[model samples]
Target: MHAAEGLITGLCALACVTPARAGNAVQAMPVDAFLDTLAVNTHVNYTDGAYANVRNVGDDLAWLGIRYVRDASPGSGAAPLSSYVYLAQRGVKFNFLMHENITQSIEEVTRLNTAVPGSVAAVEGFNEINNWPVSYHGLTGIAAGLAAQREVYTRIHDTQGFAGVPVYDLTGFEPKQVESRVNSADYANQHVYPQNGEQPTYEANGDTWMGNAINGLKKYQLPLVITEFGYFSSPQAGWYMLGVDEPTQAKGVLNGYMDAAAAGVKRTYVYELLDEKPDPQNKNDGMHYGLFRNDNSPKLVAYAIRNLTTILNTSTVQRTRVAATGALTYTLSGMPVSANSLLLRKKDGRFVLVLWNETRIWDRAKGTPLSSPPAEVEVDFGTTASRVDLYDPNVSEAPIASHRDVRKISVSVPDHPLLLEVTPGAPPRL
Candidate 1:
């Protein structure tokens, strides 16, 4: 059942799980599962009261292999220690920040980690350092701001013995700031607003939101977290990028993660779980980006996240072509896929061979890449062949596709499309 169906039955959520497919350019998994398999950390928004929700689902989520939690200034008197304890009891593991209140941030993180005895993870100095009004450095500039942050980060690490704790130094996409964030702290916590606070407009082709993260953070190779992401509706209703609706935001999350994965970013956390108040710009906003409504009922995006997590958390590897030989021959490696709504592509002259796998049933999903078992593959016989197959070593099944002797096979490409030709016993003539 699709995740939206759960909303109708009062199950609190619907889950979207896309099965693993073979030979595709893009792949996806759920946020939780994606983080877990990668052994990366995840954060839940404080606004959603997700502390309890995360606790409730902690065990199931643990299967996804998540280890740390960013409490977004929780222990600094914004919320209660019981909130931190709730997460600890669930086997979730650590904390991302205490509060920028410095002293409180340090004290609380220390207290929580000590009490939980290894559960309290790390503490961030504050939220986005480069963006936000409070972080404004004025004429001091990004370098000066980073230097200041380094001072703060160093002091926190040294004097406080907050030393062992992983300090999540965060910043905006500003190039200078990103450089500083990477240089200043242990983990590079980034906030990406791919849609630029606009509603998402879906097209027949893949959504643009998928490429934002790749373009935004491609330069850095540090351990990173997309701490916040959501569809921000513009103030003017008529000017909204996507009409104020659930489908648009749901699609945004999918496309956003797909883009992140395609860019090879392995970890991401959605902006918020709950939308308690309306955004200042648009009264109808905020609530729309949440996985759950203010009342705690799951939205379509929530289910999508859950099911995608199930797939990503499992023992499956999703990949993209960092370098391709051509439309048909290439070297592929795993990419960070957190959900199934990914578009995989290969540039082939005038046409981009792209695959759109909205539904992740690899075999059923169009554009599945067929594998040629190492033993059966030959570089001798030639008969212009376009073949797609999935070789299940475990099942000893012939390629999953029905085509036997490959000339050309009609296989659907979905969001992950591959364009290639394979001829047994055929060798390239240079």
Candidate 2:
């Protein structure tokens, strides 16, 4: 079977680890210390149209994913396009996914480099070569796909304008096919959609679909970019394949980001910013996967993403054990659950502890939704905290609560993640 087909058929059956005894156990996973790693996908064609929305979220985003099209001028003549300039002004970088013919791609790259040098950080070949529609690159099979990608890579590398820029190979849905096509490109790329008719979690066991894809690319020893990864939410089912509710979509987005960061991927761009249409009729309509609705209003997932980027984009993250004098406990949907926490120390000396219930609850096929059972978790920082603030992703308000000069804090950990901002001191030194 084709690798993409194999993944679709096999990943759902992959055994998941049975829930561990419901209780608090110190998670030993080391925190990833990379800032400016969050990126979101946007269309070059939509850059001008979606300027306002882009401006709203652009500040938090590190990179913008766009398609490189021939005859498409991001900006007129010697000046960089307004969108490019806007992103640049906000300290955001952009990467192009080459979709047009190689000749045009080369010319576009030359024009881009000449017009706005250093604006385009990386260029990727065709996208999702193993999936339908996107897979149709006028190439018949895998062999043809490889040859076409090689030509694109060679031409991009040989272009004088793209001298210092990194050219990425075509990002494919199938790992083996993508791996086989890899040549001397500066970096590697892949598109991982782990949704299996449910809300997916970051399984540390590396058995989940996303985990398998990450593992597959590790062999290349190249910096990886997950150009597209997201979940679709629809009020009515059957329109989208992995139909999820707003809350489920929100959880999936945050979980996907955390998973990719934890796996040490160089960068990850959520599939899209806005919906293509108002309401999608089927999986092929392309209207439901956006972080925002077609009406330009922010969806639940959008706020969650914004909150995650705001809190987790720290310069350094240190994993410290929470020392509590008394036992702290929590439960999810009546079942005892352990909360996962990460201590992130920002560049400004502000410390934030991201806490979330580690339990996986949604399964679309089974009609299950993300469980939001609440629990009170008491944690004592190794040192005395001058001030504490709670930031919940699900809520649209300034820190949910604030406290002063507390050595220990009792936080109500919900199924969704929460950020506890503490004054810069009192944690065990990493």
Candidate 3:
């Protein structure tokens, strides 16, 4: 894990710890571990774009507590993407995409490591090769793509500077294309986009789109990586563009994070950290992918993420030897079909039960977020005898409500997530 972690860690969750509640765990993962799974795409090389337009790139990212970034490029030798250098010195890690120029990318990674040791999280191969077909020395289609991946994978492993770094493979291909590729990756990689302002794990062709994408890449038999997946926050319409209202974007983002983790995706990188350019007319899909606007002001998703990281963080509090933790035995009632529940364990021996309703709240026709009745989720944690604190990252990091001396609690689950933090008794008084 990086000095400051992200939110993309997979089910390495409990680290093989025996479950005290057996299989009663909902989404059993450590908070710090799950925070390691989250990352965002960036454009530090777009010197004239939205990323460069605002001078507070690091400030914004630090504000949101993001520790990793995936970029198509990391600027050439001349500029060297120096803007993010300061943050890299602190803790940020990069997963540089090598689809454009593998040799140049290798050099850049080597140079970056010299400046900042242990800054490379991963090195990736051809991106969306279907759209940008690879043609190496007359090789075309999947052949060239595979060959390039092989070269990069081998080179990265052979290069002493970053040999230990994992290599992610190409995406954007048919299932046939995926099947053609073999032995070229440590992780099977793919991209997913929930269309038409839908839920992050939106339904598609009788199944969740994410599930379908994961299945399509299952031939790799390797841990999966969602290299790109996000919704643009522009209030525009048309199912193809994937633009939704900001509120919907925020809700989908949180839902998508949990959905990806729940699906066992090794990591999920949201499309971007900042809009690439200004789209005052709300017309450009690429311009609105950022968690922050072109002017560097954060969107709703940004604030929501900030609150989330703050709530889940254990570094801010005193470090103590936490008790052995297992799954929380609990029952949730009145959860709607759209509702979802995720239970996360913290290294500090706390449990955060995240509850959300994925109801369609964005009316694209009206270009606004529609209000839905809150689901009164009655939660009964088996034999609860301590305090339970509730927090809504959409609102604030501080607990919005708390309960004491109660075995059951009721939470008004809205479209977004509400975390119920339960404090277990002091190990039954020794």
Candidate 4:
């Protein structure tokens, strides 16, 4: 990776332990209501409930990124040309779905360009085309999907004056699909999950994330934009941590993005800003992967994501908690890091550290996994920095070590780490 393009996220490590005073002041307020809190930050982008929530939540967010869909339904359906016009006029980017009518879809895209001129960010031709019977049915296969994506991208780029209109090929399938899509699409769109439904908690997906990312570099070497990634494992299981339930399925969705960022994939827009509604088509609660609840309240994962965005924008590496000497020891330097200065704790309670390397090599000899239902570890840090703790702010004010003991931390070095926290009066003093 280029020095500039090298992953800055890998090097920097964040101390999850924050002094009580450095607690997220916005925790008490509803996330939806705290939209103003992110306005000044450069990382957290906002979008009103695009496909679902009717409110223009973007107004309060920092960046007003929007997903414009020309398709009418969640599953496969006709391309809604009117939807493009509506979104284009609103100055939002359109996430184009590759539909049955490629030519008609192209025509609508042209009209959108003419309508909004240069307002669209990029166009996403299809979504998860690698899934069964969609675009990789063996009849069409991955090649056909690639051709379709390239065709759409070429047409848009070759337009009268829109030669550079970027195209995003979005997919969130396994490593096989990621390889296929990168070989074809103009950009990489990945979905993430810490583990398959079988695994316990947020354990890294191992070389799965790394393999796909390296594939992207080998094939197109194109820019990456993670279209849909969250904590959902599958359509059934979801992501959950501590006492807060975030369905393992949801965690699967998030793990993809986490994996992507660690692998140095850029420009990730978390799956859906709001929870998905009944599939106006299949009607089976099509993936409850919303950052916020139906009523616009934030989920535990949402806060995790919100803080993650903060960490990504400001800090570099995401620290996972591990237990050693009956104390909390964060696996800070094991995984890949792209930051310059790795910090443990600095002034103002912010776990802001510089990254030194793009890809981190682990010393497995130093770490050991705790037994199941793991033992607790106390993480000590000063209480003077401004830190954004990555957890469900709604969690109780219990002691750090006490809270950490309730669950087991995954010890898969360079793969996964449990992100924990320390409240005020809980800092480890020298």
Best by lDDT: 3
How should the candidates be ordered by TM-score, best one leading?
A: 3, 2, 1, 4
lDDT of 3: 0.72
TM-score of candidate 2 on Cα atoms, chains taken together = 0.71
Tens digits of lDDT, candidate 4, 6-25: 11111112221222222222
Tens-digit lDDT string for candidate 1 (1-430): 0011111001111112232334433332233333442222233434344434555335434533444444554454345666666667776655465333455556666666666666755555445433431332353444544555565567657754454666655453365335335547666655544322231112223333333333344456565555555553222233212223454455456555544454445455554545544444455644445555555565665555554443333331323222243233321222112223222232221111222233221111222222211211121112333333332211222333433355333433332222222222233467
The list of candidate 4 runs beyond 4 A from truth reads 1-53, 56-91, 130-139, 170-184, 189-220, 233-244, 247-258, 278-285, 307-351, 354-430
Span of 10 residues, lowest total lDDT, candidate 1:
1-10
lDDT of 3 by residue, 197-269 (tens): 6665543223255666676677667888888878878775544444787878888888888777766787889
Model 1: residues with Cα > 4 Å off, grouped in runs: 1-33, 37-69, 93-95, 129-132, 135-148, 155-165, 176-183, 196-221, 232-237, 240-244, 277-284, 312-430
lDDT of 2 by residue, 1-430 (tens): 0122323222322221222234443232222343444567765345343434546545324322222211123432232356555655555556765554567656655665565666667777665565533333565655455666677778777777677777766654455544443564666766666544433434322336665566666667787767677776763333224556778778777766655655566677776766655554655425677777766677888777655555544433643334332122222222233344444555445566666664554654564575655667776654477677898866743578998887667777776668777663444568
lDDT of 2 at 362: 60
Whole-model Cα lDDT of every candidate shown, in order: 0.41, 0.56, 0.72, 0.37
Which stretches of model 3 miss by more than 4 angstroms? 1-27, 53-55, 75-78, 202-207, 314-323, 426-430
Provide the TM-score for each candidate, comma-separated: 0.56, 0.71, 0.88, 0.50
Better candidate by lDDT, 1 or 2 = 2
Between candidates 1 and 3, the lDDT winner: 3
| Sliding window of 10 residues with minimal summed lDDT for model 3 | 1-10
